[model samples]
Target: MKIEVNVKKRYFFALLGILLVLGGVFAVYAYNSNPPNPRVFGHTINEVDGITCNSGQAVTRTAAGWSCVNIASSGGSTPVNPVNTLSYFEDFIDRGDTSEVNHPGIISFQGYAGKTFGYIHSKDMFDITFLVKGNGTLYGLSSYESFYVGLVDASVSSRIYFFISGGNWQAGTRNGGSTKVTNLNTGVSIGNSPEWFKLRIKRVDAGTIEFFINDASVGTINSNVPVMPMQIFAATPGEADGRLHVLIDYIDLKITNLAR
Candidate 1:
């Protein structure tokens, strides 16, 4: 028998490449401290946690803790890992209680009646995306108990004017001649861009209501909604699907205007 020894350079090169990639990823994380959101384009017209944003969005919490943190995954679709899912915002009064988990997505304000959230998913650096199905009500501009939208009946209803809904969502059946236009845009599923699907209510008002997904608008209700809401919620008026999923990254409510 003869002794033979073989050395492969490719293996060494592959290991070196992996290390460099990891180093680059770490560097990017260390340098960028900003989060993905709607105003990444320019300026927005809303407030997060008592502060108005001239551009971009901000997320925070009260006496408890803040949810929605950065995570890495494989299925993430954008600037983040495609599989990353880390928007778990919650506030439990007691450490051993899980009751507060129900309203973790809801934010409370002190003086103002409006709320906002900044979120993202694996798509283009966003980590979390909001989703909704069937007839559900979401309040953005106005969170008072008296405000809300009608239903999710997409049809030839003449009253279904873009400006008529005033940025609110009306969920119902167009087959019937019944629709709840409400007095303003309260309970409407909202997103930021038309690309946004299954979303969260942005701002519901009697003059202008907006909805967003991944912090972008997908639909608008821009009529009669002039009311500004401080509280936001999701309600189901019909059992078309019988369930609603208000997937949110964080909820910011303004009890007082810290910016003003």
Candidate 2:
């Protein structure tokens, strides 16, 4: 009887030990399967504009949170190139002549307000198709305060001005005393943004020109226009208190079949 009782005690002790070992293993497995958030543990997740930033994006911490920036697509160091066949291109890096002028101050190549850009005044014009990429702010004035980029006739009285005013676009032409204008509603969308844009203006025909914003056609004008000898200008004329700032990345002029 004593031996049987001792055997029963031994068996009971062995089973209890095995059960304890199994419970410990199960506890460890459960912990490994459901852990805390990796961000909480590693603390590497970046916050952008109160939102979490994904991997491989550059970010700057703002007053509220972080801001994701396009370090790759935003700024430019190389000269702008033509997408299609071209006859002329100006990267705005080097002005080949002194014909360029800045009335209030000297023109800059280092860029304006930390934007990498330049400006120019071309003496001659090629059959025109070019992309003008930049941004500026234009204010209203009573007098003739024109901030424009486009073809200007020799007399200056006849002009096709692709200008911005009152946060709107003006595709305007003045021939002698007669004037015509087309207003585009893209100003509020384009104004005051740090992002670069592609403003393409092309001569569609002898009597017509088309204007585009980021490859989208804003408008087309049909009017009697001058020939190709028009001066390619970036100008702020008859300045008053009205302010105009245009920062250009490049102007790639191409001679397409339409130009020919």
Candidate 3:
């Protein structure tokens, strides 16, 4: 009886030892599976602090540090490359000019003071078109009494333009305080006739400009192209006699390529 009791007690202690070993192994596994600073998606939880991702951006860790990267939109659509093309058209229906007269698809400027209408742009590639005409005499007037259309810098010092003065039309460019002028010489005098004509200026490549009138190529300028940002403008200098009446049907501009 004594020998059987001792054997039973030894069996009970062995079973307890086996249970204790298994419990210790399970505890070690639990700690390894769920660490204090666990990794999520290959990044530690502490690494994502203070990182803000805006719309269309994702948080990423790089060798340089954490950054917000621009990603494709969330709609599962493929990302598209940016195309640099811009267009603007104004028909003069409501141009917000107090002195302008809005006549069916036309705007007339007839004031004694100088007037200017324009848009500013930094692009070097562009196409500008406008339809313009004069109502009164265009010759034998003061030198200041002229109309101009083209591009000009903010200081009005450098420009490339189509100029109408004293019954003649010319292509003119001013750079670095020096001026170069070329007459279109279309052989048609534009004196006082209320005839409308289209003028187009195009810059297809660097350092070259093309001029057209009524869809006919008039001239090409290869030198003195304004390198700075310019404003596409239509302007008339102040006339003391107040005879500078100009009408414009529309003005349009297209920026073709802006990759540079």
Most lDDT-accurate candidate? 3
For every candidate, C-alpha RMSD to the true structure in Å: 19.4, 21.9, 26.6
Off by over 4 Å in 3: 1-105, 112-123, 137-145, 179-188, 257-260
| Order by lDDT, highest first | 3, 2, 1
lDDT of candidate 2 at residue 199, scale 0 to 100 = 59
Candidate 3 Cα RMSD after full superposition onto the native fold (Å)? 26.6
lDDT of 3 at 85: 12
Model 1, span 180-242: residue lDDT tens: 342333354443322112334433332444544445554565543322211122221221221
Model 2, TM vs. native: 0.42
Please provide the root mean square deviation of candidate 2 (C-alpha atoms, Å).
21.9
TM-score of 1: 0.24
Error of 3 at 99 (Å): 18
List, residue by residue over 168-197, the lDDT tens digit for candidate 3: 667766775654543454443465545566
Summarize candidate 2's per-residue lDDT along 1-260 as a digit string, tens digits: 99999999999999999999999999999877633321111012121112322211233434654454322211233211211211122332332422222111111111112221222222222223233322223433112234456666555555665666665555666554355433344442544443334555666655676777666787876664544334555553332221332333233444321221
Q: How does residue 142 of candidate 1 score in lDDT? A: 19
